[model samples]
Target: MIERLQLLVAERERVLGHFLESEQREIALACHSIARAFSRGGTLVAYGVDSAETDAAHVAVEFMHPVIVGKRALPALAPPNDVRGVLRSGDIAVSIAHGAEPAPVRAFREQARHRGALTIALTGGDRVDSDHAFAVPSEDPQVVQEVQETLYHVFWELVHVFFEHPGLLDDACITCGDVAIQARVVAVRNGNAVIEKDGLREEVAVELVAPVDVGDMLLCHAGVALERVE
Candidate 1:
């Protein structure tokens, strides 16, 4: 029993270490997206059910009640008993789910899409079955749960980073490559697979930097590797 417990502890340490290793990249991606939303004057709304509710609440509290004064307090709303408020375009709905395909999550996702808000789903699944789920990739249930917490805190930290570099996003709006907008993946004809981006279903090439499987969502902007979604 003691040995098993020790092994679990060791595993957790490894998982946390891995998350830390990728911290910089994750921070960059998170800050970039948050900046994009903020640029358009959007608020952040976090929502989660079950155990993940704590994460949602944390996001809300941090923004609503900052510990330090004179700091930028973003308009962050948390999961409510009822989600009826139609937030602005700069608003975001972040969810943490193990399966990544649940009714509550889907409801929030649909609402965000309808309201023209961003949907950031932190998921722990081998494959993402939802329309847009950011796969954190965890096999162990405990690790999945713990990693969700890790990612939530990390994302909050990145939000602070974005605030520091406010000028970078607001000032220069560079033209990201247009590859994603014009990408397509088509069926192989004879010996080659053709890629098209003209809205053809099967012949649309997805310029994904990471290997994409049967189910995944590409958060593509001009074919740049901003972030991977499923």
Candidate 2:
């Protein structure tokens, strides 16, 4: 029994460490996008099939009624049985699927995308063409679901952070208007740039811009530093 417990802890730690190391930037970007959508009066619509339905419902509830005290409740809904006409432009759609990506989930994502909603998919490594596809790298179904649960919880939390910092989403920074938002590069690794903006640190993909160095001021957009602020 002790050996089994050790093995379980070891596997979970391995997977959790890998996810944190590899997917932090992606998760941050997703949170920024979702927060922007909410700021624009959008809603979060979640759905799942079979065993994944519970997760979908749980996501909706968490968003609509935050468990944390003082966290603002945002609008969220989970479609019952069918998702037709439930999504609209400026909404954020989340599809939760275990094992393989089901056909129904794919169709729902497509429909949501066509309606101009940002789509997020949590699947078992199968491509679902979502705006943000978080593939669970683990082969074990249990581990995959556990990782996905943690992922969504992180999403929910960080999105609130973005809400707290609305300046990060302003168009002035993207258009180089009078308000020039800049962040100092604290570190760079594997093409991901970590920057400190407004006293908050975030990791953004910097491949679209020129060579960056530590302490350089960068012009950021949608969680990515598009260029160096000269």
Top model number, lDDT = 2
- lDDT of each candidate versus the true structure: 0.58, 0.80
Candidate 1, residues 129-180, lDDT tens digits: the string is 3222456556776687787777666666777776787765663312144433
TM match of model 2 to true structure: 0.74
Residue 10 displacement in candidate 2 (angstroms): 1.4
TM-score of each: 0.66, 0.74
Clashing pairs in 2: none
Whole-structure CA lDDT of model 2: 0.80
lDDT of 2 by residue, 119-194 (tens): 8889876645666778877778788788888988999999999878889866333323455357888655445665
Cα lDDT, model 1, residue 222: 34
In the order shown, the candidates' Cα RMSDs to the true structure are 8.9, 8.0
